[model samples]
Target chain A: MRRLILLLPLVLFLGVAVFLYRGLFMDPSELPSALIDKPFPAFSLPAVEGDRTLTQRDIIGQPALVNVWATWCVACRVEHPVLNKLAEAGVRIYGVNYKDDNASARKWLAEFHDPYQLNIEDARGSLGLDLGVYGAPETFLIDKDGIIRHKFVGVIDERVWREKLAPLYQALVDEVTP
Target chain B: MKRFAAALLLGLAALGVAHAAIDTFEFASEADRQRYRTLVEELRCPKCQNQNIADSDAPIAMDLRAQVYAKLEEGQSDAQIIDYLVSRYGDFVLYKPPVTARTLLLWYGPGALLLGGFVLLGVIVLRRRRARGEVDVGLSQDEQDRLASLLNPTPSDKKD
Candidate 1:
């Protein structure tokens, strides 16, 4: 017992050291979305490419990716081609033009081939706010019922899609179709 | 050069003032304004992470500040506003996280450690005092005789 007592400080030091060591590699920016498994927030906003309004109901029938993006965010430009590639392979993607000018958004979509099936023009970021969007290039995986399943923050390159998002997306698609 | 430097400083100060003035809102009362200020200061910016929404210049932070002001004007209580943000952003938005099962150790760990330290100190002190008490008992017979001899030496020892 006395020997164990003498080792107590060393044990505590090791425990704390191990905990802090693990914390050093953890990404602080990756905030878990509070809306996972919850239905997407309701919104009635204009489409970027057309005069018609887009809403949560329009996205409810399919398993899709709701990608929050803006023209001002440089990372979105980096992630755009990958998104285009994914869309070519028939991945349903909906874009939220978060806090961006509609004209600029339209120009960007035109300049760089558009990947989104429908783009929600959230010029004031009201829908973004409702979705708890803090930054651009955040992609959310939604199930067929418009329920958010997972959220990936920052730029999604090809590897991230294949390794992390693809499996989840495929699972949701299979569950809905089968 | 000095004049130019002074002009640049003045320009910068004016810019700062303009930035601060951009979010001005019409409050129904002074109390509501105060509440709004407090709420913004307490709510952490989800984008910037460390800064409160009031201090951050991030667009999301600005939106949150506007939301806080709107909610306050709509007569939402402080708790209601906090709940609304927490529901969207989780407890990370609040500077003070509420006590929960996961946070139980974080809330009470330091106090428990301090209490344990005091208890260990008390035990060590008590043991030391007891050890010293044992040492303070009367000397053995042989040691007392040696002490007596040293204190009151015999006449022969004195002559030597």
Candidate 2:
């Protein structure tokens, strides 16, 4: 009886530990993709730069990055510098301007310094929902053959650039050279 | 003034009709009604913030309740509607997730830990018993005899 009483506390501790582990980490939403290894969703919109329209067909013949952002999304601002660096390295970037007015998008681009080769306005958020986007500031990497190779939700960081985008970019260059 | 009076009467009649509509949906059977209540209490209203359809005033919750009732009217079981909702919304919509291979550890972890503790307690208890059993106290035959006499209290021993 005395020993049982002593071990009760240890049993309770282990039981609680196992419970916390299951609760905290196990319930993230199932990552679903209709676009994985498939061609990018088709879209054409007025460019953030020139009067010409930018379409999905223009990006398909080469490896590219599609960044979804709005002027109101704070995380998009945080990720802008990393994108600018990617642009400086001559990475092809296309912007999917999400649910914002043309005036605001133009101002945000001017303020943050536009890194996109072509910007496509998705004003109604219909395109975003079709792409399974829950929130703003997501980046998708497409391979040279127009296949969506990767999806990064939320802000892009230097570590993500090094770990994720760099390897895929390198592989695309290798494929082209070989 | 006459137009205002007519509008007031019409508003009162509309209010009465709305009240009658609420009363018409009042459940008939005590047992069936209790089951319906239980289902709502357990099932989550997907569009509400941690609330069930029974408690939520959200339009989506009302629509969901209509769907549930339609299925019930078709003679579908409570479990069937719950299964349909789960299939559409994923397991996150379930207030109490089922105990499956994925949730095995979550459901039984507490019991397993308690059992493990009892095992440790048993081992400690057995070890203590053996340790206590090993100690021997030396007593001479005379001392034993006197001690036995004191405990037994024979007639002569009782006289003292």
Candidate 3:
């Protein structure tokens, strides 16, 4: 008992060291979305390119990636090619043109081949606010029922898509299709 | 010169106060304005993790501040406004997280650790004292005399 008591401080030190070591690799910017496992928020926003208004109902009946992107966010530009590739490979992608000018957003889509099936224009960021978007280039995986399954913050390169998002997305697609 | 410096310092201080008031919303009452200020200061900016919404210039923070002002003007209670943000942003937005099952350890861990430390120290001290008392009682008269002689080292003993 006395020997065990003498080792108590060492045990406590090791526990704290392990905790801090794990924390060092953890990304502080990757905040867990409150919307996960919940239905997507309702919105009545216009499309980026057309006059038709887009709503939550339009995004239902299929599993899709609702990607929040803006012309101002440089990371979105970096992530765009991967998104385009994903779309080419038959992935359903929807875009939230967050807080961006419609002209610029339309121009960007034209200049770089548009990857999204429908781009929701969040001009005043009201829809983005409803979705709890703090920054651009965030992606939410929504199932066929419009339930948000996962949220990934920051730029999604091919590696991120392959390693992290692809399995979850495939699972969602399989669940609905199969 | 001193008076001029003092006036300049006062002007700079006034400027600092003006900078903190980032928005000019028309509040119906002074109470509402105060509530808005408190809410912004207490809410953390999601983009800039360390800064409160009031102190951050991030666009999201600005939007949140506007949302708070709108909610306040609409006569929503403070709890309702906070709940609205918490629902979207989670409990991370609040500077003071509510006590829940997940956060019980965070709220009480330090106090528990300190209490345990004190108890452990008390036990160690009590055991040490008791051990000393036992040693004192265990010594025979002959052993006490020998210990005293070794400690004192009388003249005859030193000569040997």
Q: Pick the candidate with the highest lDDT.
A: 3
TM-score, chain B, model 2, is 0.62
Where does model 3 sit among the CAPRI classes? Answer: medium
Order by TM-score, highest first: 3, 1, 2
Residues B36-139 of candidate 3 have per-residue lDDT tens digits of 98999999999999999998999999999999999998899999999999999999899999999999999999999999989989998999999888775667
Q: Per-residue lDDT of A1-178 in model 1, one digit per residue for the tens?
A: 9799899889999999999999999999888788888999999999998799888999998999999999999999999999999999999999999999988999999999999999999999999888889999999999999999999999999999999999999999999879
Runs in model 3 lying further than 4 Å from the true structure: B1-19, B131-160
lDDT of 1 at A14: 100
| Per-residue C-alpha lDDT of model 3 across residues A1-178, encoded as one tens digit per residue | 9799799889999999999999999999888888999999999999998789999999998999999999999999999999999999999999999999888998999999999999999999999998899999899999999999999999999899999999999999999878
TM-score of each: 0.87, 0.50, 0.88
By descending lDDT, how would the candidates be arranged? Answer: 3, 1, 2
Two-way lDDT contest, 1 vs 2, winner: 1
In model 1, what are the clashing residue pairs, if there are any? Answer: none
lDDT of 3 at A44: 96
The residue-by-residue lDDT of candidate 2 on A43-96, one tens digit each, is 767766578876778777778888998888899999999999999998988888
Docking quality band of candidate 1, CAPRI definitions: medium
lDDT of residue A92 for candidate 3: 97
